[model samples]
Target: MSSIHSVTPTFDEQVPFAAIKERIVQAMCAASLGAVLLFGAGFASMETLHNAAHDSRHSAGFPCH
Candidate 1:
């Protein structure tokens, strides 16, 4: 009895070269956009917190003046 051997490359070979390249580019763009949005939100929230703290300490009735 003789067995046949498969010569296919697997995963990367399953898809065409152009398609794989397009997917990689799309994923990179999505990651960059996500990073920008996350950092932007964090910075905005930090500034708001700082302003609130400063205002509370400067209230007219406080003895720390």
Candidate 2:
């Protein structure tokens, strides 16, 4: 005969709220920075700046075409 032991973790053990909040904040900041850079290029009025972003999107498989 064999005996088996089973254990389950509590809700708090499954996920930490602080870590999730930190990750969300970091993601938001990164997205905001990218958005700023994306829009800021328009104000610079440089063709290269605009094309660089366009090309990067295509390379990333964003289907810009």
lDDT of each: 0.80, 0.85
Cα RMSDs of all predictions? 11.8, 5.3
What is the C-alpha lDDT profile of model 1 across 1-65, one tens digit per residue?
99999898667646789998999999999999999987866777777867765688788555443
lDDT score for candidate 2 against the true structure: 0.85
Stretches off by above 4 angstroms in model 1 are 1-13, 45-65
After superposition, the stretches of candidate 2 with alpha carbons farther than 4 Å from their true spots are: 1-12, 47-65
Return the TM-score for candidate 2, rounded to 2 decimals.
0.50
Best by lDDT: 2
- Top TM-score: which candidate number? 2
Root mean square deviation (Cα) for candidate 2: 5.3
Q: What's the C-alpha lDDT at position 64 in model 2?
A: 69
